[model samples]
Target: MALSIRQKRVRRISGDPVDGVVVQGPVDGLATGTPLYSVAVQGTIDGRTTCRPRGWRFGTWNVGTLTGRSLEVVEELQRRMVDVAALQEVRWKGEGTRFVGAKGGRYKLWWKGDDGTGGVGVMVREELLEQ
Candidate 1:
C-alpha cells in the first residue's frame, strides 16, 4: 500500500520541550480520539488529501498485538510525525529490526513475547536512525 503523504514544508517539531527535537503540526487526515490505523484511515478535510509535515513525534502505547497490520501502524507513525514510538503488548516473536511499510524505509522492532502474549518494542524513524 502506498502511503498518502503530502510532502509539504517540513514541519519540524520536538517530541517534548525538554528533548529538544523539533516537531510541529498535527496529522490532518486523522480525527480526534480515533485509532489512526482503524478502518477509517483516510478522508479529506478541505478537498485535499491531508498530509504529514516533517517532525519528531514520540509516544508510548499498548498495541495489544502486532503483525502484518504493523504496516498500518507505520503509516500512523509518519502521519503523526512520531520519531520514536514505544509499544507494549506487541505479541510478536523473537526480536530484530524488521523493516516495514511502502516507503522501502524501515523501523526497528526489538521484541520478546511469551507465546504471542506480551511483548515490547520501540520504533525509530528513518532519518533519526543512526542514534
Candidate 2:
C-alpha cells in the first residue's frame, strides 16, 4: 500500500496537507546528506501551510571500500536520533543494510550504486510516514 505524506513549505509555521504521502515522525534528527525532496501535490491537497521541521531523521552513506566506516555512520545516526538514512557508495559494507534493518524502520533499499563509486541508499522510519 502506498503511504500518505504531509509537507510544510520553507519557513512556514504550519504543514500543508498532502495526499498519498505524509511526512511524520522525527525529521530533525536526520543525518547529513540525506535526500529530502520537496513535497509535491500528488492527488490534489488543499491547505494553507508552509514547510517546517517535523522532527524526522534521515541518513546518507557514501559507499566505497568503507566497510569499516559504514558502522560509524550508523552509530553517529543513532546518537542523533536519526530515524531515516541514505547510504551512498554502498559496496561491500553490508553493514548499511544491517544497520538500517536493525533499526526496524519502514525502510527502502535501492541499488543506485555505480560500480561501488556513486551509489545511494535511502532509509525511512514508518512512524514518520504518518502526518
Candidate 3:
C-alpha cells in the first residue's frame, strides 16, 4: 500500500517540562522513509517563555529477533550529521569502547541502562555539542 500524508498541529495547554508526544502529521508528501516531523514547543517554565525546536525522523526496519547486527546499523547512522543518537537492541561486552570504536570514537556515550537486554542508549557528538 502507498503511504499517506498527514499533518497535525499541537498546542500546549499546560507547562510540562518533559513530554514524549508525536506531532500530528507528516511534513512532506512522502511517508515511506524518514518522514520528517518538525516540532516547535513554546511554554513558560518559571515565568519565562522558552522555545524548543525538535525534529523527529521516523524509519522502519524489519530486523528480526537476534538478527541483523548493531555495528552495521551504527555505521549507517553515522552517515547522518546527527547530533545525538538514541540506540536500541544493542549488545556489547566488556567496556563500551568496543561500541565506541565501532562509531569511530566520534561519539561519547552515556549508557543509561546496561542490562545487556537491548535498551535505550544515548550517543552524543563532541563537536556538535560544543557548539
CA deviation > 4 Å runs, candidate 3:
1-5, 15-36, 42-74, 93-105, 112-119
Q: Which lDDT tens digits does candidate 2 get at residues 1-131?
A: 44433433322223545433334422343334334333323333355443343455444555454445655655565666666666656664233443233554334344454455555666555456454
On the 0 to 100 scale, the lDDT of residue 17 in model 2 is: 51
TM-score of each: 0.54, 0.41, 0.43
Top candidate, metric lDDT: 1
Cα displacement (Å) at residue 48, model 3: 11
User: Candidate 1 or 2, higher TM-score?
Assistant: 1
lDDT of each: 0.58, 0.47, 0.46
**lDDT by residue for model 1 over 15-120, one digit each (tens)?**
4222222222223332223222211222234555544333455656677677766887787777775667778888887776666666645666566767777988
lDDT of the structure predicted as candidate 1: 0.58
List ranges where model 2 is wrong by over 4 Å.
1-53, 59-68, 92-109, 126-131
For residue 112, what is the lDDT in candidate 1?
A: 71
By TM-score, the better pick of 1 and 3 is 1
| lDDT per residue as tens, model 3, 57-122 | 333222222125544544544554344555545443223422343434465554433455554455
- Per-residue lDDT, model 1, residue 98, is 69
